[model samples]
Target: MAAGTLYTYPENWRAFKAQIAAQYSGAALKVASTTPAFTFGQTNRTPAFLQNFPLGKVPAYQGDDGFCLFESNAIAHYLSNEALRGATPQAAAQVLQWVSFADSEIIPPASTWVFPTLGIMQFNKQATEQAKEDVKRALTVLNQHLNTRTFLVGERISLADITVVCSMLWLYKQVLEPSFRQPYNNVNRWFITCINQPQFKVVLGEVKLCEKMAQFDAKKFAEMQPKKEAAPKKEKAPKEAAKPQEKKEKKKEEKKEEKKPAPEEDMDDCDAALAAEPKSKDPFAHLPKSTFVMIEFKRKYSNEDTLAVAIPHFWDNFDKEGYSIWYSQYKYSDELTLTFKSCNLITGMFQRLDKLRKNAFASVILFGTDNNSSISGIWVFRGQELAFPVTDWQIDYESYDWRKLDSDSEECKTMVKEYFAWEGDFKHVGKAFNQGKIFK
Candidate 1:
């Protein structure tokens, strides 16, 4: 009965929640991504958009009656009728409990364990093992609960099942291999039953369960790091023992060196451009210089006391008006596949934005695993606007939601501490921090 526009990128799991609810309720939910409508990053980053959804996050909705809302769960519940939501007040409460369970119990460990396998995050043996144990514990609980139950709440599918299944979708598809998942037979059956529902199937077509458990490929991951050439060994010989043969060898080496051609004169246009280009002029040149030096802050935070000393020092000397703080969340999360690839995407962007390092300090993080994940970060830049310019090479910058933070706010202070420290439960994404890259 309700008609509205849902703004989000394609195949977003959060958006799928609303879409599935709309399907069951016959709510006219039009995807904003269709032609002449919305483009992730660009449209959302505009000043006009901030007026509507100030956070600039996706799965944002605008109803025909001028009702506007953000956040996936709220939008989904709004789209659903009493049947899909819950039959009774008790059922509704139970449904909410399961939804909360999915966020709290299942997603954190699931993301930590599975993201590294997907290559979105670098794997740490100790952390990954702990994550696996946590996942096993959560799954055991779910399996025990579902042993006699058809659904997460009551009979028939509800918002609880939809939200939970969507939350666990990537776990089943990415790293919950048969061997790992076989112990939780009840959970598997419940998941299968839920996905088979026409509403789920239509929204999430043909869910492919993981065939083989994807293990961390270390050598392949090592290859991703910039390699270092081995140091040449020194050969010691008595100077007096120098002979004619040594001279001949030196001649031979000289000949070999002579045989090597000089660097190529004709290079690709990109390389030529890069070579011809002077070191970038300071993009933040226009902004008033800050009294707080970034390098000092980095060294103090990294080397000195993190919370006790560094935080106090930062706030005491922070040039709030001169330097701006912004939160930049990765867009096109639906396009993210394989955990490693997602992390690589972040690394690649960081590498490409070589221009931003001098003026910006950021911590871009990869959360969750393959097929289901998100990349987001907090950026502190020299100027009051996004540091990266709009260009072909800078296209990736557009694929992020940017919001300025009030440096004086408690939320800003907390974000700085959590993001810089790379710890804390990031409630916005509903997943624990997996790994982060610091743009120092």
Candidate 2:
């Protein structure tokens, strides 16, 4: 009976809950995503949006009668039929329990693990492994609960089933490969059943699970974040007390040494650095290409043994005279606010350095959350000299401070092992680990 308009990002699993609810209830739910209805980021920032949904997070619903709702669960419950919600008080509480379980028990680790694979956020291997285990446990519980029943609550499909299925949406599609998920047989069966329902199928067209789990793509994650225009450099305020002779000397020096790029060219260089270009080709053109395939090493690091085998193999077969190891850290940690935003900035920087990826390996980490975070990375690139110079990457390269890491030192060995494995106590920053973005 709840007729309204819903505003949320496309393919958002949260919004899918409300949409599926509307489909079953025969409610008039107009989705406002593009053009005359709504434009994300722009419209959501407007006064009207804030007035209706004070929280401003999506799956926001506003009915013609002026009833407004925020949060997916609230919007979903508002739109559902009495049968779906539950006919009795006890059943309704039971439905609410599953919904709460999904939000609290499932989402935290799910977002940490799957968001990176979707290129929405960064990855932390330790956090991801913990998430995989946490998810398996949650599914084990659900699988046991669903082993007998066809639906989560009662005999028919209910809001509990819809909420839990949508909650598992991204995990199944992004990180839950068959081999990883084979243990949760009943959970998989329930998920397929819930999604195949007419209402669910209408909102969620088709569900595709990962064949072989995809690792983080630093380039894609960085490029996916909305681009922020570089703020113009503010000219320093004139020194009110400077003598006439001093001003004249400064002006003369500025003319002699201050050759600034044109505004268009400045932007062009920054853009070109990230974009593919014909300016430079084959950075290793001077040296013979190493017979040791970097890809094989990467596969080993990703899937096979890392510290025990891969790193040793890397050193054993390393083109030591050709490749060099370097430690790189963001110089603007003081400017990073919000853990998520800081991670995104690092991702963007790595994306801008995509050309160097083939020549490089890095594990950049964010140390804290909002206003207290720092970004530092360990990089191993194809050449002895920094790979960014005389190339497109130089535009963003200046933003970082780089130090050559000695590949021979025991300390360097530890750093490479810890950072590359995405585990171990990171002794560098001396803070609890937050998350990491891989520049592979």
Candidate 3:
């Protein structure tokens, strides 16, 4: 029998653990609940319980080997390897990538945007707006990438898709109304496909799409209020009694005089005067053309030593408005070379820059080749200069240069701008990287 027991509340914490349980149905993974039936603080916080998992957080795991793990992602990873590492190394790597992406990219905004709107989390109008924008931007990235592909990381369903889909469950259940999701047709399609998977269906039994909650409807509600009393109608006088027939004939004569057309000379003069007026130039003609730049990085990663140090520095000093970061990987090679180790590495880089959480946003993409096997894209920052400090992991100063391109340079500017606007071909690199191990 498998040696570990997983403990978590039923619905709140189930999704994260569900991925593993679904993958490893018979893998001796006992789920201990801390819900109403088995309260954590009320009854399960005994020394024995504390010893097994000190954090007291639901979803903690205690292994038969006596190893305890906290954090959903960590436990899910362990369970997944033992339960569902797939038939090949490449499949395993894709799973890791998607799982990391879910934790990093999806959860943050979900916590920030969806929860608040649902009243599950405190609502701050300003914060919610920002969160909405962030999520929209992130989803846009995902939708574009998903335009051509099916799963989060590869052709097949893996832990990555499972993880991300689980995180999104809450949004679908509470916030993704048809109005909101209509713009994200691809995301909706991919989500539907994922939820329909046998394992996903088993884990998320009878999951239903939620109707969007109206933000506020006080005015409309008020307008629908019933009137206290009926309004009195005003009486009208009879037409025959109101005016005499002779007076009506005189009124008709006056109307006839008014109906006579002005002379042709007067009409022609009016047309001539109107035709003399000058046309105005378009108001927006002089507006400065927006410029963009695409900074491509395509170096090979043999070991962590060369690029590890530089990535963090670049993230720290990265210019937020002047540049945008799109995490890119060779698509096909991504499912191949992307291992749990690499996923953790990417996650670490993102975490190191966590301080820029609000100031800057980042995303990842998986492209399908290895020769130009570039994990590269553009950063649309606010200024002409690349203000962000280069990290030790970065190859060389010359390798990553940011420049202002001609607005007319469609080829260069559009791709970079698309990365920022969350438009174009790159798929959403999942959010798992956001929570994965970060370099100090």
Candidate 4:
């Protein structure tokens, strides 16, 4: 029996394989994934841990007798019982074959497709679509092979089944929605059977299949971006050297301006005048000034109680003539995957639309759990038309279906109150509120 300690992160699908093997083999496997026992980033970087597992990746293992092992597959194989290793030489080779199949065929495409949905990786449309094809091919292979057999290599479950199932865990949980995975019926049946087993259940608990395919979340990718420190201010150039460069830049600008064509002699005075005048870049500059101060309302919403102060202030001071209320729903609800990722999408949109903050406010909400969710929000815009006047705001805006709401209608008020308060029946959403984000 292999009695040892496994070093890994919590809920790591890689570590689950070794833990599942230990369960079946009756090995004493103590998982060190939390504080005191182990701290992932810190512990893995330490010289002591690095000496045993040179690669520093997990699930690394240290046996009771000081036998050190690294790589999840190697550790899992070490912990597996004779039956799981396969009874005969031929069976052992078959087990190895299936294990290799899982790693080479299943994991790559699975990770490529699932990581983006979890917000762990940047999404590429072509790559993801190809990955879906690859996943289908891998599942098709498994579906055909498992058509008559109870397990991959032998009559009973073995390392092959364990490895393959662990490798496919994320794909099944995040992207393999019912309609998408319907073709692989045999693989599905086998997967359910393996997961429901005592050994697998001990490590994975109750596995939930994905009800809806998850999409790439831009918000998560943005949050994951590294925030670099500001560079030190550069010393000013010598005055004499700067003067000549400044004069040269000014002359270049003057020459460019002088090269402009004169307005057509026959052109109308209004048309020529309008053409000659420089256009202001501000999108909302054309809109009439409103009595409602967006900045003040934003402050109240942030600093005071929503129901008691903010909601009342909004209704009392709302400038319906100068502004408009609109309901926006994400067009691709069926493609939404994880709750956190969906929330990130909202955050990403808010960040990109920072320029629109002075003219607009919104309360976007994500509803439901991973693999089944929707996104919708109430927006206040400075003008009667949609607030996105320029292309920058149009990026994420076009993805949503926008509807102008009657500002004085009770139903609109009720929806706005619920969104602003981050609570309400939200009956139209047909899902429980998971989280919300504010654009101010």
Give the alpha-carbon lDDT of every model.
0.74, 0.75, 0.51, 0.80
State the local distance difference test value for candidate 1: 0.74
- Model 4, residue pairs in steric clash: none
Q: Give the Å error, residue 103, model 2.
A: 0.4
TM-score of each predicted structure versus truth: 0.52, 0.56, 0.46, 0.53
Residues 1-440 of candidate 4 have per-residue lDDT tens digits of 77889987778888899999999999999999878898665577689998988866777899999999988899999999999999899999999999888876787678768877776555645446758888898999999999998889878899999999999998889989999989889999999999999889978999999999988887975554333335445556666645667887986787777656442221212222323334347777777789999988876875567799888999999999998999999999889876546766886787556557678889887777777778889999887988774424675888899999999999899999989876767777763434332211
- Model 3: lDDT of residue 143: 92
- Candidate 3 residue 321 C-alpha distance from true site, Å: 38
Tens-digit lDDT track for model 1 on 159-183? 9888889888888988888998999
Judging by lDDT against the true structure, name the best candidate. Answer: 4
**What is the alpha-carbon RMSD of candidate 4 to the true structure?**
20.1
Where's the lowest-lDDT run of ten residues in candidate 2? 261-270
Better of 2 and 4 by TM-score: 2
lDDT of 3 by residue, 341-419 (tens): 3434443455444323323334433232322222334543333434245222232223333444443355544454444
TM-score ranking from best to worst? 2, 4, 1, 3
Q: lDDT for model 2, on a 0 to 1 scale? A: 0.75
